[model samples]
Target chain A: MYTMKWIQQDLQQYVQAKAYVDTIIVPLIPFHFSDDASLEKDAFQREVLSVFMRELEKEFSGRILLSPDYHYLKSADKAEEVKRVRSWVEDSWAQPFHHIFFMTVDSSWKKFEQDMNGTLIWLPQIVTESMQFSERQSVVHSQVQQVGEFIRSYWEDDK
Target chain B: MSEDKRPVSRRQFLNYTLTGVGGFMAAGLMVSPLRMAIDPVLQKEAADGDLTNVQLAEGDITNEPQRIDWEIDQVDGWYESKVSKTAWVYKDDNGDIVALSPICKHLGCVVSWEGSEDYPDQFYCPCHDGRYYKDGMNVPGTPPTAGLDIYEHKIKNGMLFLGKAQPREEA
Candidate 1:
């Protein structure tokens, strides 16, 4: 239920009720289906990441905001990309949000984890063809549940 | 001419009749297994519409909105997955139990109890900042075009059972 989209009326209500929303989640997605062999796998990974993020939002609705996805080029330099990512985090933090979670399947973010101000949750990129639907559901359900628990602890720690 | 007179014996006639009856009896016996295999698919659709127990006691319901999280087994095509569902439950002034779907009507984002700063007693959405009143009604100037949905509920043996939430009538 976490989304950045709202009509004019909803935005007005959000502005007035800013204090109640305390956390914001931003997903960084890298679009890198340049090669033919990896295109399908990459696309599958993207879909999985999307579902996982939605699950997280559903788990902690009202407490967190699901902002627009952060799309970046696969060929881009990770070092330079950190600045752009930091900017997005800063912009979202301007609100009274006490927690900002960066959800990503990109391995590049691993290096920038310490540099970034927010918490970086880097999920291992999955090979979609290797797993069946039922297996994937179980794998996703368990891992996503753990991630939810981790983020929950942060909120709990605050209290 | 010879073939026409081949089954004239009484014993031969009885054998033919016995074989014919056996085939029909075997098919009749198969009907029970066939029904057993297919009945669940037909009956499941109707039986699942019944309410799910939320494990809350009648005395536990208070005026303040309390979030309840539970999972339900959902069958989609070939896979059976447990989908998590959430609801906000509380008691109104008249002491009636009230349950509302936390999803925002504006754009399907999850709404929260007292999530907004301005609306202290209202359900607020962080996505577009939608708001709903305490009675699950959409605020006049809020983003939600309709009131929040109320869940079908009943109390059995002091326990609350909740079904799907239906759209409330708008005035």
Candidate 2:
């Protein structure tokens, strides 16, 4: 059910079962090649966000379609980017996704959250590299659980 | 020394040479197919590494399904990483232990035991409202086309060891 790796056969399946798949998860990732200091942080966020997205997809694969990552420059203007982001959500409506979510670890996206068409979920970035392996896993696991609950709450709101 | 040096007739030479070459060709032909036939047994032994000890003891499982998490090392192409897996374990009416994979059959979402207030005593998937029975059978008219997967399990030393979850055929 993960749309991240789209094959023709899966696409056909999705098309046939389009009514059941109502949710879409769009991961917003920022890349920074401008400075050495910001580069490492951006890279870490990308990896962590990927892990989070993968887990979330696994949790809600039946009802959700994971979009190919939406990458933007780290230094880009959020106000200007809102238009493109909203356009992406609008395009997804062609597939008729009811609940579109933009998941990101970047806090700056919070400013334009209201401007975006879908729900803009901002998660705090975790510096997992320095943390112990098990500790980092536990942290990510708990966060994923919380996020799963949050998504469920949205579904509950509809009923 | 004299007997060893004796010159063989052309027929004897042909016989020995043909036998040596034929043996080499026959061995080369048979080895690959032989390995292919035995390969599954070898892989099964390797797959035994998948059996993991879930911390909960055999005595602790109740009628209510409990979620169990365990870490396993997964090697996916290049990256070797630790992946956490989950299973819902409980004792059935007949007092036999059962473990089910949470992944929904319709579109692969995770289902929770008695998740929805409306659907009591049933596993519910929040995604598309898929439902499964207590025995992991998919409820008809629900989103799920097949039943939930059942994990292969064994009890040793009073501890539960679970292997992979095998998917059930359409119900």
Task: Tell me, by TM-score, which candidate is best.
Answer: 2
For model 2 chain B, the run of ten residues with the poorest summed lDDT: B1-10
lDDT of 1 by residue, A1-159 (tens): 334333465456556556656777788888875788877777777899888887767645545667778899877998888888888888777868888888888887898888787999988865366888777766887787688768767865775
Q: Which segments of candidate 2 are over 4 A away from where they belong? A: A1-12, A126-128, B1-49, B75-82
TM-score of 2: 0.80
Candidate 2: clashing pairs of residues: none
| Model 1 reproduced share of reference interface contacts | 0.14
Enumerate the candidates' DockQ scores in order.
0.12, 0.49
Off by over 4 Å in 1: A1-13, B1-163, B166-171
Native-to-model Cα distance after best TM-score fit, residue B138 in candidate 2, in Å: 2.1
Clashing pairs in 1: A10-B128, A14-B129, A17-B116, A17-B117
